[model samples]
Target: MTVTVQPSPRPRAARSSGIGRLLIAVYAVLALGAAGRSAVQIIERFDTAPLAFTLSAIAALVYFVATVALIAPGKAWSRVAWAAIGFEAVGVLIVGALSVAMPQLFPEATVWSFFGMGYLFIPLVLPWLGLWWLATVRRSERVAAAAEAA
Candidate 1:
C-alpha cells in the first residue's frame, strides 16, 4: 500500500522579522561603530592602545559576521551565527573582566570594554539575545520536522 502524504511547507525567513530586523539594526550599529573607531585608531592613535583598538576591530568583525549570519538563510550560516554570537558573549565577559581587574591593560574602552558600557550594555546583552533567538528558531525547526514526519 502507498502512503498518501502532503508535502511540508517551505521553511520561511522574511526580510522583516521584528527580531531579525532588530538584530540587523544592532549589527549595523556595531559595524559602523567598529568601522569608524578602527579607522580613527589606525589613522591617528594606533600607538596608544593597540590592544584595545585591535579588540574593537575584532568585535566589529564579529558583529558584522553575526549580522549577516542572522539575515541570511540556511543551516550553515545559522551555525556560523551561533559560533560568532558565542564568541561575542565570551569576548564581552573576558574584556569586561580584564578591563575591571587590570586597569592598566586597557587605558581606554573597546566595544567589549566594561561590558559594552559605551554602547549602553547593548553589546553585553545582544549576544545572549542572539543565542536565545537561534535556540528558539532551532526548536521550532525540530517541532516542524516532527510534525512533518508524523
Candidate 2:
C-alpha cells in the first residue's frame, strides 16, 4: 500500500495571473507610502495646512481600501474595488486641477496634487488600470460561470 498526497488548489482570488500580482504589489506599496506620509503630516504640521493633510489622510484610506478589495474574493469585494478606484480617479482629477489652478488653496501638496506628481503620476494612472483589471476579472468570471452552467 502507498500513500499519495494531493496539494490544495490556490484560492480563486490568488489564482489571478501576473497582472493581478503586479496590481496588488503596486497598491500595497502606495497604501503604505500614503499612510506614512499622511500620519507624519497630520502629526507634526497639520496646523500648517490642515486641508492638505486631511486630503492626504483620505487618499491613504482610499489606497488602503483599494488594496484590500483587489486582493479579496467575491462579488462584494469587486464592487468595493470599483467604488474605491472610481473615487480615486475623481479625487485625483479634481484635486489636481484645483492644485494647479489655485495653488494658494492647497498651501501644501496632498497625494493627488499635480495629478500625483509627487508619486510620478502613478496615482493618476493606477485607478484606470485597476478599473480595467476589475472588468477583466469580472468578464473571466462570467465566462467561467457560463462554461460551468453549460
Candidate 3:
C-alpha cells in the first residue's frame, strides 16, 4: 500500500500589491512630512500654536501606524489598518471643519487642515482608499480560505 500527502494550500497574496504599495508609499511620505513639520513647530514655536503642532504630531503617528499596518501580514494588521484609517478619516473631517469655522484656534496649519488641501487632498482620500483595499483583501482571504477548506 502507498500513502499520499496533500500539499498545503498556497498562501494568500500579499496585501502590498501595486496600488497597495502606492498607498504605503504615500502614507510613508505623509508620516515623514508630518513628523518633521511637527518637530520643527514644537521645537521652534510650540508656544505660538501648541494645538496645531500637537495635532500634526497625532497625524504623523496615525500615518505611521497605517503605513505599518498596510505592509504587515496577518488579520491583526488588517484590523489595525481599519482602525487607523477610520481615525484618520474622522480626524480630517473634524479638523477641516474646525479650521474653517474657527480659524483662530489654529494659528498654524496642521496636516489635516482644510482637508489636506495643501497636500493635494491625498490625506483626505488615502483613508477611504485604504479602507476599500482592506475590504477587498478580506473578501479575497475569505474566498481563499473556503477554497482551501473544501
| Cα lDDT computed for each candidate against the true fold | 0.85, 0.86, 0.91
Over 42-119, each residue of candidate 3 has an lDDT whose tens digit, in order, gives 999999999999999999999999999999988899889999999999999999899999999998999999999888
Worst 10 residues of 2 by lDDT: 7-16
Error of 1 at 132 (Å): 0.5
Please write out the lDDT profile of model 2 over residues 1-150, one tens digit for every residue.
Answer: 998986543223331355877988888898899999999999999899998989999999999898888878777888888999999999999999999999998999999999999999999999999888888777777776666566
lDDT at residue 49 of model 2 (Cα atoms) = 92
Question: Once superposed on the true structure, which residue ranges of model 2 sit more than 4 Å away at CA?
Answer: 1-16
Give TM-scores for every candidate, taking all chains together and pairing residue i with residue i: 0.89, 0.88, 0.91
Quote the positional error of residue 92 for candidate 1 in Å. Answer: 0.4
lDDT-superior candidate, 1 or 3: 3
Model 1: lowest-lDDT 10 consecutive positions? 9-18
Off by over 4 Å in 3: 1-11
Q: Could you report the Cα RMSD, in angstroms, for every candidate shown? A: 3.5, 4.3, 2.4
